[model samples]
Target: MEKKKLITDDGIRYDGRKLDELRPIKFQIGTLKNADGSAYVEWGRTKILVGVFGPRESHPKHLALADRCYIRARYHMAPFSVEERKSPAPSRREIELSKVMREALEPAIFAEFFPRTTIDIFAEVLQADGSTRCAAISAASLALTDAGVPMRDLVSSMAVAKVEGKLVLDVIDQEDKQGDSDMPMAIMPSKNVITLIQMDGLLTHEEFIQSVELAKKGCMEVYAKQKEALEEHFKKTMDREEV
Candidate 1:
């Protein structure tokens, strides 16, 4: 089968976005009543739900750290999340992404504040589009904040890809699968600290720098959306209590 063209002659992506444009992003906080905190995010066609549990005692006893909270993250996809059903059991990609998600959020968290405890972040992909890990990271960050975890700043993420010999931001599934380079990145926007950067394909030195800048721009926008969601949720919560 032939691959569809990702970019058009007029510099528009197949999804009708400019090279540096991002997909429409939507976020909601406090989506789960049972969890300590939760958030849901919809980025383009991707959907994710994240639940953050505990600065509580570590289970199994031995997993507890001496000076800081152990951060555990699980990134999972529903069997029906994709067009084709995925295995219910954890896949190697899911395990790797779980580790990656934990690392990305750890840098922003003040784990020592809740010493010997555990903070577990669970990200569930309800639907997979492109850049599912990036979406999950963004939602997990919001979920952590929703759980009242102390953090230096929120982690926002996005992917940049070299498609058809040109760089584009917020790649879709096709672009990611067929592009020359696909880089997913996360940053603590307030600190301007990069928390995660991973590439699946090749890029020249110049392209890497350009992609970083593009990804930064995308993350900043995502950060704004996150802040808006948090503020709105809190405002509504306060209003309900006043009643």
Candidate 2:
């Protein structure tokens, strides 16, 4: 197969992006009122919403330490998110993805500050074309910030994939299905520290390097959006106070 061939021989990929381009993103913080913090983000066709609850009171059977807050995350897809309706039950895939997302977010958050409490991150996928896991992580990060949770740095995530023997940034749904491999990564941009990384399929060392580079480029874009959203949130709050 020609690998779905969204791009043509003239050097254009599907959606008219260059090999290393990512989708445009729109993000905002404080979308929810009751939650401590919340954010919403949309990357191309992928839409995700995240809500944060507490740094307060760990539930029964605190298997983790009480000296620091526990980080819990849930990843869910709505029935109408995809072309086909999804099952309501929480499947293994969602559980695993949730775990990775939690890890990616924990380091950036000052979880120890809330000792004996729990921080719950809930992510809902309203529409998913590709890179939903990355979207979830990004959204959760923003929601934490919106919730006024202290953190060392902002975390952003992106995905890179191999298509037709070439590396591409921010794979779309169709590309994901047809691509040879996919790698999703979360990073703390200022520190250049990688928080979470996952990959599927195979790649040579050279390909891996190219994919990581492309993913970093995409992540930088995501970070920019994250900052913009936070600034907007604060600006609105300041405006409200003034009024």
Candidate 3:
């Protein structure tokens, strides 16, 4: 079988987006009534929902920390999320992503304020197009805020990739599978702090620098949308209360 050309001479990708262009993104806050806080996100064809429950007491006493609340995170994908049905069992990638999600979000929240408790983040990917981890972190941050978790700042994340020798932003599944590199990053937008960053594949020093700059630009766009969605969510809530 012949390989598909990922990029054209005019810098258009196979999906008809230019290099550095992101897939369509949408966010909805407080999607679940039972959860303390919740959010749903759609990036391109990828969809993920995150729910936050607690600063409640830790179930196992030994798991509680005297100084700060423990962060318990889980990342799971539905069996029918991808074209090929995923196994219901948690895979190694899911376990790793869960840990990564925790770390990415921990720096934003003031865990010390709620001692001997646990803040649970449940992220479910209903579909997987690409950059699911980045979308998960973005949605999880909003869920934290919706749960009334006080935080120093919110995290926004995005991915950068190199396909057919052209660097692109907001990588999709096709690009990631065939591309030369994939770098996912999370940052506290207001504080200018990087909470999580990981790169796979190869890049030169120059390309790495360029990719970081590009990723930062993409993350800022995500951050702006996140804030806009939150503002809209709160506005609707207030309007409903007034009615």
- Location of the lowest summed lDDT over 10 successive residues in candidate 2: 234-243
Give per-residue CA lDDT, model 3, range 1-243, as digits (tens): 467998999899989998988998999999999999999999999999999999998988899999999999999999999999999899999999999999999999999999999999999999999999999999999999999999999899999998988899999999999999999999999898889999999999999999999999999999999999998999964655563
Candidate 3, position 185, lDDT:
93
TM-score of 2: 0.94
Q: Write the per-residue lDDT of candidate 1 for residues 104-125, one digit (tens) a residue.
A: 9999999999989999899999
Candidate 2 clashes between residue pairs 3 or more apart in a chain or in different chains? 129-173
**TM agreement with the true structure for every prediction:** 0.97, 0.94, 0.97
* Rank ordering of all candidates by lDDT, starting from the highest: 3, 1, 2
Name model 3 segments beyond 4 Å from true. 237-243
lDDT of 2 at 161: 88
Tell me the TM-score of model 3: 0.97
lDDT of 2: 0.88
Question: What CA root-mean-square deviation does each model show from the true structure?
Answer: 2.3, 2.6, 2.3
> Which is better, 2 or 3, measured by lDDT?
3
- Candidate 3 — which pairs collide? none
Instruction: Point out the higher-scoring one by TM-score: 2 or 3.
Output: 3
Q: Give the per-residue lDDT digits (tens) of candidate 2, residues 210-234.
A: 8788888889999998888878778
Give the distance in Å from residue 223's predicted Cα in candidate 2 to where it truly belongs. Answer: 0.7
